[model samples]
Target: MTQSTIAAPGRAGSRGRSLIGLAAFVILVDVASATASSVTLPQIDGWYAGLEKPWFNPPDWLFGPVWTVLYGMMAVAGWLVWRDRGLAGARGPLLLFGLQLGLNILWSLIFFGMQQPGLAFAEISALWIAVAATMVAFWRVRPLAGWLFVPYLLWVSYAAVLNASVWLLNA
Candidate 1:
């Protein structure tokens, strides 16, 4: 085989390793956010019950697993884009990704820690917008990366509607 072709796998492997590093960074950020924004069970239960949740809203039991999966997918999607495009190539998407993730954690803090679903609703609106922008940017570089975020976007959209409903009902 030619030198060029032989070098391809090495290049790809290097890209994969870099993607894994990016994924690790994203995971660490997520874990730190979760820890910083955490509310205990009693606190969550009290705040949640006080809110006027919509009948269509999922039960409390659903959030943990759903968010876990979504978070995993989110990391994978970001990694894919980073792999294909690298940091410089995917700067736009990466920025949007970080912005949305920040908003995501802030929503938990507002709703649970601060006991303010109303403000959480507003924050989540920005999160949704950021997610959309991120998806668009990812699409330009890695379509699969953008696609991987679809489930996360859909779930967040549903949660946004639920947040609005709770805020309105309790108002």
Candidate 2:
């Protein structure tokens, strides 16, 4: 039987707990991506600070709080999908989740670790696409889940322009 139709003794409680875990896992993934990408922070303090950034670029301090909330929302979105059909049931949605998450982490690595603004710009463009795809897929499974990514998509869109500007100015 499907998840909504299932009837069991402790299944509801069990799923409630597991869903929390799943959400936490998604948050952790975001944290890990941030951590790995942080290798570039030092560069930002020195080399990056020397580069010409657009007037509209946000202050560095704003990123931490923004990402924390975004990550939490992302986890909730993923968990909603997982809660619908468990691991196997939400395989397609989860796979899209994984794809976007990987792209997220990869963007940090490419941008900060490699110190290649142009390359990183291209990478973030792909990340934007991946995130959009994930959001669409999640929405297909659960409408609320899809809506959760709205802010994320908007932020990434802004980030893309910032990235492009930085690359051009630096080049």
Candidate 3:
């Protein structure tokens, strides 16, 4: 006779807890990325003061809180995709997500830390491309996850124009 094995209730509960832990890790990554960028803030502020900003540029106060919320949402979207698809399914999207995040970090370093507005503008343009590719990859697996990136894309689009403007005016 063939015997079937069943998962124990305790084991199932443990599995559920682990899944929650994984989701939390996604959130932590998001937080960590932002923290890394913000750690170099004094340098950014000093460089920013020298720039001739367009009148339409957003006030400095708005950036921190807006990014905080956006990063949280980004984390939730990643968690959702990870939960829906096992790690194997999530691999492609996650890779693209990571690429965009890296590009995001590079933008801050080039624009603010290095005080190179022109190069920063070029970097942000590349960031937009990475973000678009990431969004497309995420959409293929999870439509909602793709949708979650829309606000981020829009904000970055604005940022690109702002970067270009800064580069031009400062030049």
Candidate 1 — number of clashing residue pairs?
Answer: 0
What TM value does model 2 have? 0.86
Off by over 4 Å in 1: 1-16, 22-26, 40-42
**lDDT per prediction?**
0.76, 0.79, 0.74
Q: What TM-score would each prediction reach against the true structure? A: 0.84, 0.86, 0.82
Model 2 lDDT-worst window of ten: 4-13
Tell me the lDDT of candidate 1: 0.76
Displacement of residue 79 (Cα, Å) in model 3 is 1.0
Model 3 clash tally, residue pairs: 0
Strongest candidate by TM-score: 2
Candidate rank order under lDDT: 2, 1, 3
Estimate the Cα RMSD of every predicted model relative to the unseen true structure. 4.3, 3.3, 5.0
Candidate 1 accuracy as TM-score: 0.84
All candidates in order of TM-score, best leading: 2, 1, 3
Cα deviation of 108 in candidate 2 (Å)?
1.2
Question: Over all chains combined, what TM-score does candidate 3 have?
Answer: 0.82
Cα displacement (Å) at residue 76, model 1: 0.3
